[model samples]
Target: MGYDIMKNNNTKRLAVSLLLIFPLLVFGQKRVEAKADRLFQKRAYALAADEYEDLLKHNWNTAYAHKQLAFCYFETREFDKALPHLQEVLGNDDLPLRYIWEYALLLKAEGKIEESEKWLAYSKMIKLKNPLIPRLSQDSTWHPVALLERQEYKVEPVSFNSKYSDFGARIYNDTLYFTSSRKTPENNSNYSWYDEPYLDLYYIPLSSLDQTPKALEGGIRSKYHESSPTFFKDYKGKNSVFFTRNNLKSGQYVVGKKRINNLKIYKGEQKKNGTWDMSRDLAINSPDYSNAHPF
Candidate 1:
């Protein structure tokens, strides 16, 4: 009986070990296609291009792979590398309008004027509602034209600007709110795409520019990103705030294979106590799409 109990315990231990290591093993065993897709979704276009090329080397040539490879090269501005794949995908009947538009731009960049004009005309015809397409179609001659007049203005950096990325400044009444990725013990995790600390909402009094900025109170900041705060009068006529944050599920940010840290719009109300009472995510937010830069 004791021997049987000991064997059962050993089996449980082994099962636990496998459970712990399963994700890593799966990630390690991911195919080139899967890895390339994930990297593309994560906006790691350079790495994704390499994996896509690996797929091509293994004769995994498909329309989708070629299109994705072209997109990756296009995003990285490797126009020469992107040209052939773009041409390949353009031959397909079900090509998206954006791809055609990009291919047209690439042709123009490469000085293939006649070919570029053809693709540009096709793209314009496919997307008639897009105003830019009409302009491009009209102006088929692609050449750098110097601006006759330039407007220059003096700009100065804010006093509270830190060494880290500080941007997306907005003003509400006399308060100035902006996003920053300053290092803090609570926000130590680095954003993979930018290699920077997670952004947080910080504010200072516009009247008192010399004052140091402070992170907003009332649990407004999280371990993940919180940015682009916009204040407006809601239907209730109360001062309401809207900001962008990563979608959280079960008190944790959802992240895994084919899953990304998508941004959502969160609403907050200024309470009588001067602290914000943040509500759940707005109905407009979706885990699949990023909703940011609220006006």
Candidate 2:
């Protein structure tokens, strides 16, 4: 009886151990998925695809695995292999906006023009919330995927510091606010390894007919490393300028807020003494997840 009881207790312990191990295994798979996502962001599409495929091999997070794999294939222009994965993503009700444009482009490439159009329409209906759509549309290669009939988008080549990486644009009061990593003594010198200078916000006024732009504030440059600058003019009377700073906390994460003399994003208005007051941090941004390339 004692031997039988001991054997039964051993079996119960083994079952419990397996149950605990299962969750840990699931968490490990999620970490792999996150790493794959980061690899994709860094433009290492081939490596990301391999990691995504590895996650799928374990039958873990199949939906997301397929979706990310499709992105990798699409990036490398392996459209033939991308179709089934894209199809699986679309078949699910919780389809992410991340790959809608790519999927549409793939459909069009495969001679499924009508289906591609439908996906494009659907993407537009949702306002293409993935934040990657505008960047993709701006690329000459992916313009056809946007499905916009107009050959010309009425866009003029607005120039800035030629070295700025990942420039963002916003139109307000017929003016454009953009970011550029030109050169500076403080933040600019930090780019010793990389040739590009630190990024800062700049703006230009618009003309009436041709829509040409000239520098605002007499080409006044900010004193901070500002990139991804945007001007928000909402339905209300709130007119504010915003930008993201890389050097805020060691140059990886970005924070958004009202423009001060510095690159930090905070909420405040210029006081009568010419100093900012009531400054606050943007609640939406995360420390771990730097909001690079805002829409």
Task: Candidate 1: list runs displaced more than 4 Å.
Answer: 1-30, 41-70, 73-96, 103-132, 138-166, 181-185, 193-196, 207-213, 232-240, 254-263, 269-277, 283-292
Could you tell me which residue pairs clash in candidate 2?
181-198, 181-199, 267-280
Residue 96 of candidate 2: its Cα lDDT? 67
Question: What would the per-residue lDDT of candidate 1 be over residues 1-295, giving only the tens digit for each residue?
Answer: 9999999999999999999998865554457789888888888787788888877765675677799988988776567788889888987878877778777776665667688788777765665356677676556433221011122456778888887889999999889989999877767777654456889988899889999888886756677888999999899988889998888764588653447667888998887777776777888877777888788
lDDT of each residue in 1-295, candidate 2, tens digit only: 9999999999999999999999999899989989888877766677788888989899988988898888778766567878889988886667767677778776666656678778767887766566555454444255554444335567555444353453576776776666655554434543321235655554566554344233223112334345554555435545544445542543244333422123344333334443323234477654444444445
The model with the greatest lDDT is 1
Native-to-model Cα distance after best TM-score fit, residue 28 in candidate 2, in Å? 3.5
The local distance difference test score of model 2 is 0.60
Please give the range of 10 consecutive residues that has the lowest summed lDDT in model 2. 212-221
> How far out, in Å, is residue 126 in model 2?
5.7
lDDT of 2 at 143: 52
Q: How many angstroms is residue 246 displaced in model 1 relative to the true structure, after the best TM-score fit?
A: 2.4
Cα RMSD (angstroms) for every candidate in the order listed: 12.5, 12.3
